[model samples]
Target: MAERPVEADTEAAGIRDVQAQTRAWAALWRRSSPSSVVHVDATALSDGTGQDADDRRRSVRDALASAGAPARDRDLIDDILAEPTGAAGPCSRFLVVAEGEQLVNSVLSRPTVPGEIVAYTAVPDLLPLLLDRRGDALYLVVEAGREGGEIHVLRASQPSALRRTDVQGRADSLNKVQAGGWSHSRYQHHSEEIWKQNQTLLAAAVDGLVRELRPRFVVLAGDLRAVQLLSDEFSPGARAISSTVQTHVRAAGSSRGALDEHVAHTLGKLRKADESAAVDRLAAGDFENGAVGVGAVIHALQQGQVDTVLLDLEAIGPRTLFALAAGPWVASAPEEALGAPVLDSVPAAVALARAALVSDSRLMFVAPDRLPERAGVAAVLRWPTGPAVPGTPRWTQTP
Candidate 1:
């Protein structure tokens, strides 16, 4: 792996810490209560010099006004976007989620947008806040050596890294001198045995790590021979997702940037592979534990059968769907579908997202072209959807 360039300590560079910022948003997602949540996404129009600044924050606030957010809440948004320290300097966009007058959460970051403002009152438009954080998650990094190695465990919720564990096995005679005699041959045999023993133990440690954290992937790097030995020792399950990198974190000239980039690249490949596999399942007419189309997906959500929602939010757009105010949150009609009173019609994406949220299911965004079926809605379910029951539904990854 090649070394990636580090930032030159720009003012907003801290905000670009993807791991930390994403965890912050994920925590908010779990803590927020469903209500009249106001979500706003705005692109900066220009420098904060009078009118040009308002061009960026205007439309969203007007939309908020139309949606009837409390006056105080509306003013708060304007004040933030108006301040030079708020959304203009070093940051290119402003995103916030509020409830009534109190602000719930806000994320100011460096994502460029030409001209756009969005204000939606629903299950907190988290998709936008989290969109840039794809295929990034906790993973383990292993630096192998003939004698032993080091393992780095990254935390999903923390700032960046969590802990490092060193597994040092026997190093006796690791570098045997060729004395051209029986003793030399004996020392060589001892070193080989030590290396194998080291790998065997290291593989066990890795197995425990994979079982414990279920990391997105494991990165192995170090001396070629030792790395291959350790890789070959992994159990079938662990070997499936473990990979080798040319650059080792412990190498003399290695920088953290290189290892970090490799981990990220490995994560991205895992995501692309997963997306392809899921799409294949859908395309192959494998609906046993799958659901496609809006109606089926919704029914599965209401029934708590959905495990993951494969969505194409851009395709779903502004379409709305009927939902219930109480339990069994989604329904097509009041008396006919569910006994609960009618909940306000919600954007189709949010409805599915809300249902998935309540049921602890995941929402995964897929490419629009790949999801031309089912109104851009599909799922991999907890159990086989099996035979469609004539009514229910066609019935469904990541943190």
Candidate 2:
């Protein structure tokens, strides 16, 4: 049918957000029985019920049917169109991804993105949405003030704040501190104590969230003294990942747009930091718990040793890899993965991705040249795989 461009939205949305959805679906992609699942990625022509919409729906249906998409999942197109947002008339693009009988997820947005439909595939095709999302995974923003702080946990992919917990501190409505007054010293001390308690309370709340979510980014904003106190009171781990903003974010009449811009900037900084950390590790030859090339990476996946698979698709996507109908999921040669007349060969990127997903490992899509030359695929392991003791269970149990 109509092939959607995978890199269509890369410039608008960052890669971190794309990685979030990839992991999210990876968690769900492993549940199906072998050769039992197919993913449907489709975009509707219009959010309307007129003749044009009818023709578009028919076209999608015919294309999917021709491509052998399961009728059970193909019907989800109607269910997706039946959703309330379908009639909202404001969305510029509507996306639906389905697996077997499950309507996995749908996203409606107001960007001038192209409309296309992909019926189904053995491997969940994440490439199309990779560049098309403007959302981020998990992040935390603390808007601190005299009243305390609002700890907001956000995932832009979803509609609203996933969690917002407020830490109430003493609102010391300090009217005035007259130096000449008899009670001035006592009043000043009491006010200072209230401020201290407020910041301490805020820090405790933030620390709890940091430990709970281990968010991708954490930002603190408010009065300088209040921010400083909160930062100082925070747990070391929390303070290490958090950035501070001078804006009075929680203040009445504060601009949300401005705060969002600052948060986005922080996200960019964190991404760079992560890239640098990975670069330094790899550049220093830190392969003790990592794999550096395609063969080693495939072996790591076979052993169920990977935590995250780093891929330079530009270098590896078009290459070929063999897949098996049973355990030892993928290999460069059919014989290595238990060759059979029924064994299938698939794109290297797709085969490795499926292996990673089924093993509950993550995928990190890096810029093409970020990887060392010829090291198109690599992985950081969950644990060491070399020199295992006899009788040890080295592989993740495959379904």
Candidate 3:
């Protein structure tokens, strides 16, 4: 399979887009008879030389063959194998095989982690990878000045310039006039006015971006004055999402490696803090709108009450959960089947993931240590579950 190179586009993808894609893949998986799905997670950056790349491709091909991929899908395999490797940043690729065709192929960056290969009955279990790749913040680098400035927007560590403009304003030399005492002061005032005007322009741009992107966090880096002024311009909503880094825009550009390291560190901290908070809330016995076990999470998901389903990845292995093709419910036993007919017992994680997607809920793969419950699964509800108690023992019965 020769890997195909996928161009990284600048357009940001929203949650709705992810949901829609998941639904589409789910549908494809359901329709393909004997869906020969093959998932290969390999490094886009090769460790050695050309031989290493060849070895990588051969390994992927061998894996695909072992996964029972039909020979008719060779072209698709080739495309997947040929994807450009050795990019400066982290890269991950996903290919979905179904209906004897390559339905979806995407090369992603960030979360530059190790890779693996998996062959599932129908759809590839992509939920964890997707969740891991999800962006937690939007980085906006703005150049300071009244005359010219550049705005670069980075989501999920992928950078793209969103806006650039020349902000005509008073020059510094105008404020440097000597011996023209009163005139110097007047020029200084003029320079201040120009700076204010520039700030207003930048503010308007930032406001529009904030409304459009609606990112979880807004990271601002550049001139201190510009950063402060832009921060002031943010709406209450934007202000709530904004954060700042000390690095200047030019310095960040010159040393992208350092900037990325800083961004990663900051985001890592934020993610850990968030996971802790969610775990705390779940453990608070506030079972009204949250669940602490697999059974409860399944029940909430069935009722479309789940807003975010959290899983302790370590606790969940290749366990299977019976679910239907068209419903957002999963059961540990056949006797617990809901209204929909049983499709198959999919990987527990995949079953939960499909259910979440069907209900338009988010999925979070949490570390085992962070989870308060040893049950391996939990969920945050969109609405309170009222008197409904989860994991009541009866729900786990075979009959």
**lDDT leader:** 1
What does the lDDT read for residue 378 in candidate 2? 76
The residue ranges of model 3 lying beyond 4 angstroms of the native Cα positions read: 1-51, 110-115, 118-120, 146-148, 157-175, 178-180, 232-234, 251-262, 280-285, 338-344, 388-399
Report the lDDT of model 3 for residue 315.
76
1-399, model 1: which lDDT tens digit per residue? 112233334213332345445445544444334322333343444345667567656765787778766566677766655544443434434445455444343343534322234554434555544454444466778889988887776633223345567788988789977798898888888898899889888888888878876777788988778889899899887898788887766768776776667776776677788788777765454466777777778777878888778888766666777655555666655553467665567667756766666566766778776664435788777777557566554333111
Ranking under lDDT, best-scoring first? 1, 2, 3
Candidate 2 stretches greater than 4 Å from native: 1-52, 82-100, 108-117, 128-137, 156-159, 177-189, 283-296, 303-307, 333-335, 339-345, 380-399
Ranking by TM-score: 3, 2, 1
Estimate the lDDT of model 3.
Answer: 0.61
Q: After superposition, how far is residue 277 of candidate 1 from its true place, in Å?
A: 3.6
Error of 3 at 72 (Å): 3.0
Which RMSD values do the candidates have, in order? Answer: 8.1, 9.3, 5.8
Candidate 3, run of 10 with poorest lDDT: 1-10
Where is the poorest 10-residue window by lDDT in model 1? 2-11
For 353-374, candidate 3 gives per-residue lDDT tens digits of: 7777667777677877665445
Encode model 2's per-residue lDDT on 259-290: one tens digit a residue.
77887777666566666666554444335556
Of candidates 2 and 1, the better by TM-score:
2
